[model samples]
Target chain A: MLFKCLPPGAEIPGRFPGPVHARGKWFTIDIHCHVRSDKAAAMVEGNAAVSHWFLETAANEQSRRINRENGARTRLQGSSPEKRIEDMDRMGIEIQAISPAPRQTYYGADPDLGREASRAINDFIAEICGRYPDRFVGLGTVPFQAPELAVAELERLHKSLGFRGIEIMTHVAGEDLSAERFRKIFARCEELGLVVFMHPDGFTEAASPITILPM
Target chain B: MLFKCLPPGAPIPGRFPGPVHARGKWLTVDIHCHVLTPQAAEMVAGNAAATRHPREVYANERTREVNRQQAERNRIQSTSVEKRLEDMDRMGIDIQAISPSPNQTYYSADPELGIATARIVNDNLAEIVGRHPDRFTALGTVPFQAPDLAIAELDRLHKSLGFRGIEIATNVAGEDLSAERFRKIFARVEELGMLIFMHPTGFPEARRFADHYLVNVIGNPLDSTVAVHHLIFGGVLHAHPNLKLVIAHGGGYLPAYSGRIDHAASARPDCCEQIHRMPTEYLKQLYFDTIVFTHHQLEYLVDQYGADHVLMGTDYPADMGEVDPIGFVEGAAGLDDAERRAILGRNAARLLNIEIPAAAG
Candidate 1:
């Protein structure tokens, strides 16, 4: 069979498994998956609109199922290292390159708030990847509206946290991706060879339907 | 052997000639050309020492020199009606839909100054187009930063001055075109059935693009791209489905990269929160020009958006504009005779509702 779901460490029995070596098996990687941090969740918890919307949506249902299936272990929530590894094993994925969920970037917030939120998200992602060294890599988030701060965070993510790249929302507070304000960010990314993953946020309007979704 | 310079006013001339003919001939209209009105020139000259926006200031001697040369070329080519007509004849273009040069839009100015400048520019353009009604039609400028004033001027231009359309910049003082404040102006444009020609001026945040002419080469197209994305994702197009919006510079980079937007919208619910359809579907509703500078580029534009949506555009009177627009269209590989005719003039004629001469072939 081309696809199979095997338990982790099953291949080597008594020893920790190396790469899966079942006959005719191939290693697979999913690069676009997103992860959420508890700190990021707590920050948005006070926003009643987002919290209520999330509780009523399919996303919340999925989150509940993951938590329930993992026996309510705090570290086995959807974005937790333990949960990610368990899911990866079940799905036959060899590695997963995780990026901050777009909502966690918080680029629309005030500059200082945006910077602090981005740093926290980046730190959490780095820690998650650190725990599962061979099975995961992380991409950081930056507060692009503040280019100077964004560049600083970008460098710290690369040099200190060992992040491979950054994820950016399609627009920053209604400004286009091509706005001259972002040139420094682009230049720094080019210099650092950081892969830019452009993710879309809710459309430019505050009345966007997705605005109801939890951040 | 494939290219020929058609004689002016000649019927069935070897080259494509201007749309109007003494005898019957195929019409060729340049829809994307610009003219700098005398009023605009006077204002700029009068305001030379005024406080300048940081983006407008030249950063280095080399940058100043390059801009000076370009500005000189623009002054000579853009200001004189006779020179423009002669160039049109030389290029085998018959009619031109002239708009005030993008620089003259001047949305950066204070509301009163901007409104005054727009009126002067619009009147000057009206006068120029009036002199050669057979050879020219004009699009008006408005004080976009002041929405109320812009709507009033739009009504005046459409009713009194007989303009069929208005030209606008991509943004007004760093505000996106999709900002809620601009919705009324857009609704008016739609209600009045006025065509929109969106051109970009100096890009916001152009400090890095100060050197290498990157501002024009890269910045201009990026501005158009940004404008279109906002209009699409912000639900402007969704609300105004019949809006006859035309983007210059071959619809910028949007037509080429729209698939990425479509993919993003499909994969994420947030991206489609406003519009139900994909971004490319909205792009197809818009029109593009042939100012992309090369046959392959024009061909790609025609392919990405159908030939009927593509029109002949020469930045006109600017150094960067196509010098041989007819030749460029004639040389596009794989275009059939009908496709060539549509792109050259028929499409623009239909869009502007210009009556073709009965004798035209």
Candidate 2:
């Protein structure tokens, strides 16, 4: 039984746990997926910190235009929940662990605002998972740049919100993952036996790969 | 000593070690690099047997095509050896071990042709390295689809061609690395004490990620994930305990995620009977390359696998690759001098068994 991506509006052939119908189906885990709503994207876009980082890190003329455009739109974009569920249904994916899109990972300096935004996103993700318990699970976000706040949020998400894990980018700004500052979060995660989904927000210094829309 | 790419015809820096000036300086040994030639690309593209497999199994069509194009017109390729050497000189790279691009691993039905094609590419690589004895070395290629032919080529590379190591894809099509058919090859490699550079080709039926760019970006890691998982869970590593294998892309997300594997294994003892040891123990035995482009990742890789088990790599000539591999490791915070040295070059030396002349460093 192979795992395959089914076309949109395609009929699901059997039980979710039944043999995957996709070609060359490896183990049936969808480790990464994203969700976005227009309202949520707008709120993030309006944030001053996001706007500031967008300006500072936008290296080229084209990247600057993209950063400004995204900032103005104030909308989250990636895979819609409908599209995500459809894709999962097509691929015959048994479990889908969804997280905030990578843009949320790069929440620039304002730690207070970062925490506020993260709380909102976590609450939203939890709701989404609750709405579709069997089909979906969420990996929460915390204010990683601010270690103490990040740790506190991590505790709340795991102990209270019931998220299975937290999604963390490989680095914050230029800080390495193994830095002593990050050890606080790592220690907590190690003790809890929770998974940390480590991903990268494109090449840190280079703006070319991250900002520009792919051709 | 920051590493930077140079364009063609860039001035050969005065700082570079030339016949006139040789001095003690930062020593850079690039253990991972490749030479993609037009002949190699044609060999891969022309092979009907290789293309007979489903395209859905490919990681990224664009990445594959770009690589193929680069190989087809080596004359117009972005990463020219002249430019690479200039940049190496600027960055103080004293040595580089060139190997076949894993993209060229496709060889169809004819094992004999696969062997011949591998020899042709390897000989070309050997020639390039031979011309720059002071600054380069070659790792010979093998047609993994043909294990017997592969071993024979390995002997030839080690003996006649004087290559330092051999390179093979992590899995041949859907076959396990620990299967009986590959034991003879592994035994020969172990007997020769040669380092086997294990790189991931596209995942089996990897093309599904095509729409989202997941195959190359995500599927490649998953492929490595499955390969290493099998190596440990399938008891391949345990059977041939001494088989030295190096994985690319920071061991493809294995180090950070290994704890879950052991937890699952212990939790489901009945299901995981095939795996005997903790995943962490097996992880410690494997070597990972530093193509994972962040400092923290470098630290995590070193922390989880130990400094001596990490080596430097840059998937050169590919857009989806690191430009300054050594700098990335060096810049990693919390890494002391000893760990830094080990990951940058020393570990690769021990693994490849390259004897550094006392006068060089």
Q: Pick by TM-score: which candidate is best?
A: 1
lDDT tens per residue, model 2, B1-361: 2214656666433222222212233345667676765576676675666654333444356655754654554433333667767756655566777777775565444797788778888888788777777777888788778888998999998898888788777677666565667767878887888887877765655433444446667666767876787677666676667878888788887776887776645433221444556656776788888888778888888777788888887766455566666566667887987887777677777877777667644
DockQ for candidate 1, C-alpha atoms: 0.04
User: What docking grade does candidate 1 earn?
Assistant: incorrect
Candidate 1 local Cα displacement, residue B113, angstroms? 2.5
On a 0 to 100 scale, what is the lDDT of residue A49 in model 2?
A: 58
Off by over 4 Å in 2: A1-215, B1-24, B51-81, B269-271, B359-361
Model 2 per-residue lDDT tens digits across residues A1-215: 11123345554333232353773465566888765533445666866656444224635554456456644543323435555566566677756788886667545757887788788778888877887887778888888889999999999999888998988876676566666888999899888887889876654433322221111
DockQ of each: 0.04, 0.02
* Overall local distance difference test of candidate 2: 0.68
